[model samples]
Target: MSNERLRIALARSGHTAASLAQQVGTDPKTIERWVNKGRVPRLRNAHAVARVLGVEVRHLWPTLNGRSEVSGPVGSDLVAVYRQRSDVPIETWKTMFDQATESVDIMVYAALFLHEQISDWNGLLRSRARAGVRIRILIGDPACDAVRTRGEEEAFGHGIESRCRLAHMHYRPLLGVDGVDIALQATTLYNSVYRADGEMYVNTHIYGMNAYGNPLFHLHRMTDNGLFDAHAASVDAVWCTARPLTGEIPDGSD
Candidate 1:
């Protein structure tokens, strides 16, 4: 029986037998056997192949579920840590955006830097969405109490709310696009989440400090219950309560 899942994943990731085998350090014939005969690779090779294919090991071989073990300590999910979000290189962010295959989820109060600092933020998102990636964006409601308090805490006065409005304006064009959903969240955000598939950047919120100045954790999902799962759950919770963005935010409002 042919391994349809492996074949589809290879197609979506633009990898053929020769290319995948070369990256996985195996012969092209072995890769062919895995697809043509449904032969599962060894555990180590399975993980290596999944990593290169930007997917979970179990996703390609369902029978291997619960058997894949993480080699490091409990904090193995942590890939890197930055003293501040600004410390992370721009190229790293771009690479993350480009490599995502399944989904891109972001929840922030007012991540103006994504647009102002990141080159072609809007264009990247649109291109990703066109590639059938599910995109969920949750921006803070500018008129909500949470936004006002966050502004006061950060000593931005009403500047934070203004920034939120500007973010809304920048994202307005994506409202009607397929595979993209934007919403207004009123929750008092404790951490801002920026996720691409199984990897994420978590910006910890600190009182009286700007978000960009706070510590940021880069995590990749490894175990079923890990730091990555915790942050991913928070994103889903907020997304459930967030109201869908319907129209534009008028000027001089709130």
Candidate 2:
């Protein structure tokens, strides 16, 4: 549990070992021992130190909070947390965008941002597939009962169908590229996923609001009991029940 974090916190708080020792009711030598010798202190002392430093105890020592250190294939528990889907940083999205060399998978209802916000995203996918990167995109079936229900419940007008079709329009050119596949699914999805080979970003939906306002979780591949494979498997299951996109849209917008 002991690491340089204590020292760093003390530094950030502009408090020397002697001063922090005084604040936490510890001897100056004890503080030095913890900082220099990597000695972990009792919970009481840890709490006192964290209180003085204006940080949580877990922030200082993650293993102290009854949770063991996260260890798995990718060697961490979570990648990043976002309050909403848009809260995910552009750099992070670009990292996922530029990193996939083997495959890319997507399962979403109305991922308009992919085409509207991301510059030439589908075009890049085409190029990647042309270079032998397999890609699969699964969109919600607008004609399905679930999509109509979600739209009526959320009052998003009729654009759910339009957005899905438009997104497909963006990907239509990729149909000619080998290894690229697009489909429509009727699965009831609470979360939309964007996955590459090793990592994924998940956006959890909240009823009566749009998907953009939902919480997001970033997961990475791990050896066991990791969310990466679990979510990926869920997407695969939905994909299995999905139908291939025929580029036919009832919406005249596209």
Candidate 3:
């Protein structure tokens, strides 16, 4: 679609119209015409533009993609793509975290409180790191060192030193790393995880709807590229200015 508003969005997002056009394999004048003339290109071109912009193809066609289609499982309700969280099984979380290859961003108000379950998660991180996954952790100030120390101390006690080490981890606040391609935000009050793949997300919230009062909400497989991209943007905005945690070992002893 050739809309000035879309052009503005692209400009504000650190992308130039010409670069975007080149990425989508379109001429600069074509992009200029679309922005200045409010012209809607063919569906295929629109999709190509959306892909280049890292947004959903339907962003240019809200009527079709905005509507909520069958998402999530039985029980939990579908609340618009940008809002609802997917309360999936713990196993699924592990699987998804394990599969994360390119980037991993997590924002948590509380550190991983399940230190007893540290081995599996630590192993996952180490394995991912070894495989070259860019991993980042964001935790509230009050919980940052407590979590790091707790996890490491626990690991030491169990003779699992390397697995629990946070030397390679980076800690910052929610607003410090906005614009990151893929990220997750975890809040204790309402535990939610936003796992992004491209612009789509497999948002899983572990909150109120667990099997036996466990802190798992419901699971939603949202394919809305626009909404997912928007969420990722929001997280990045918050992460951009948030505090950065330095000195991995807390005591500066490595």
Candidate topping TM-score: 1
* lDDT over C-alpha atoms for residue 11 of model 1: 78
What's each prediction's clash count?
0, 1, 20
- Could you list the CA RMSD of all candidates, in the order they appear? 7.0, 10.1, 12.4
Write model 3 residue lDDT over 1-254, tens digit each, in one string: 35544664475346676887878788888877777776666777888876555444444333343453343342122222433322333443454455555666565433343233444555566667677766655444333343344334334321222222332243222223333222222222223233423222333333223212233322222344444444555556656645555433232233
On lDDT, the stronger of 2 and 3 is: 2
Task: Give the deviation of candidate 3 from the true structure as CA RMSD.
Answer: 12.4
lDDT of 1 by residue, 1-254 (tens): 78666786687688989999999999999999999999988999999887787655655675664544245554656666679999876766776777778999999988998998788898899999999899999998988888989999999889999998999989998889999999999999999999998778999989999999999988777667788988999999999999998776734354
lDDT of each: 0.85, 0.75, 0.45
Please give the TM-score that candidate 2 achieves against the real structure: 0.68
Q: Which candidate has the top score in lDDT?
A: 1
Model 3 residue 197 CA deviation in Å:
4.0
lDDT of 2 by residue, 44-111 (tens): 99999977876546546656746654665543635556799887656557556555778899999868
Candidate 1: segments with Cα more than 4 A from true spot: 1-74, 250-254
List the lowest-lDDT window of 10 residues for candidate 3: 180-189
